[model samples]
Target: MSGARQFTDRADAGDRLGETLRDRGVDADIVLAIPRGGLPLGRAVADALEAPLDVVVAKKIGAPGNPEYAVGAVASDGSVWRNERAIGGTRTDEGYFEERRKIEAENARRKAERYRGGRPAPDLAGKTVVVVDDGVATGSTLRACLSKLERSDADRIVLAVPVGPPGTIADLEAQVDEVVCLETPAGFRGVGQFYANFTQVSDEEAMAYLER
Candidate 1:
């Protein structure tokens, strides 16, 4: 990436991203943010688009012996996005992947239920949905969420983020109707590198953003 930081914080990044979406005349019926970090940005983006905000939950299926390395991801609705390259490189077996997928899918479903707090899931049929995230690296979780949306009756699906690597961005473009990424830095390391204050977001704080 550039030597200078791209954003002071997530809120700042969200403001810029929201502005960019507005300038592009992107219409959204609802904004679904990946919980925790994405909630803050989703708030700003929802406000900008004049739409309701909600969370689209997914959990990363980490590699064996290297839990931080994601081999795939599973969405709340059992939608999955597997990284064939990562699976092959990590030598993740079919049984292992299937077990993890079931576990993670249940985890994601529980999270979505908790985040929704008993409210019915959004009616996405024929509606334009925008999926927001703080940023992405491998984008496993995002791909899973997008997969869920793709299987839904949504009229259109848009993926929006603050920054990501070029290769990941290009791959994501094929999965959605449109992508609204503010920055795609060449020398990317991780999403936090582009922000000056990349603090962890709590579930409590994340849920608050959905309160309107």
Candidate 2:
């Protein structure tokens, strides 16, 4: 994906993603964005599709020594995705994984509540769901989110992201019903590098998207 237009920010990425989805006639009954960054994009997608926007929460389970490195992730309902390679490579103990999973799951649940604000969760049963994100890297969090959705009654699960690495996009294709990624460049490093104004989106700023 050469000469791709750099995203001005998360909102710009979301706008582009919305246009792509609309062009494909992607009809989503609901749009769920992973919080803190995905919200901006989710808002655009929901508006474009004329669907309701909501939050889907997940937290990374970092490795033992490298707290920044995600070994896996867990969703609000305790649905988990574990990176066996990361665990084995780092010799991450079972006790450590267990502890983090529990903690992260709880954290995810809390975040979801905060964003939704006592609103009952939208019924995914027999509904078309589009999970929007700014981008993807290792895809640990996304895998966990998909796993959680699989356990639900969602009729279809489509993942729509603005950009992602080719390898990660390939792997995720097997997990979801469909993938709509605008850019799948092999030269991907981090998600931030593709954006001209890739700023850190605070929880306060992220939550505002949900309110609107």
Candidate 3:
């Protein structure tokens, strides 16, 4: 299928992906979404599988002088996943990373509190966690999320997305137990390019999805 026709939005994509997993008898342990965009998609998957949905807040740490270029990402649990390759080579300074970490950590905390509403995170012990996102570009955020989840007591980690660059999907395959990506295009531009109605997901909307 063409990338243009793959998903109406993150929610629609999640529905189709959930159906596919059901067909394969993959009830993927627990649903974890990267808010705030991933929450709506997570809700659809949770409803489809009759599973619980929770948020995994991770902030991308962008390189100095280039906010769009991610050097790493940090999870809410204080887990930091760094791309050593991106460092030093891209003129990324030492003190800059430390500063970014502090700022991103605070941002992640606010997002967690806003969406979770003081709700305790689910115990991942002995459970298979399915991590969902609206889409992926460089996979930096997901890399950190999966790294954090791996340190947890979860049995397995499955990364799911509606669409992503082919290279990003390949890079994640080794890190995740399973990857359920609907579209991996070589000519990928951005996540929004693939969706017809890719509006920004508000924190309020994300909270409502979690409450459901």
Which one is best on lDDT?
Answer: 1
Minimum summed lDDT over a 10-residue window in model 1 is located at 1-10
TM-score each candidate: 0.98, 0.97, 0.94
lDDT for each residue of candidate 3 in 57-130, tens digit (9 for 90 to 100) = 88999988788788888887767888888876787887888889888877887878777888887889989888
How large is the C-alpha RMSD of every model relative to the true structure?
0.9, 1.1, 1.5
TM for candidate 2 is: 0.97
> Model 1, range 90-121, lDDT digits (tens) per residue?
99999999999999999999999999999999
Best by TM-score: 1
Per-candidate clash tally? 1, 0, 0
The C-alpha local distance difference test score for the whole of candidate 2 amounts to 0.91
Residue 111 lDDT, candidate 1, scale 0-100: 98
Each candidate's lDDT (Cα)? 0.94, 0.91, 0.84
Q: lDDT score, residue 114, model 3?
A: 73
**Per-residue lDDT value at 160 in model 3:** 79
Which run of 10 residues does model 3 get worst, by summed lDDT?
1-10
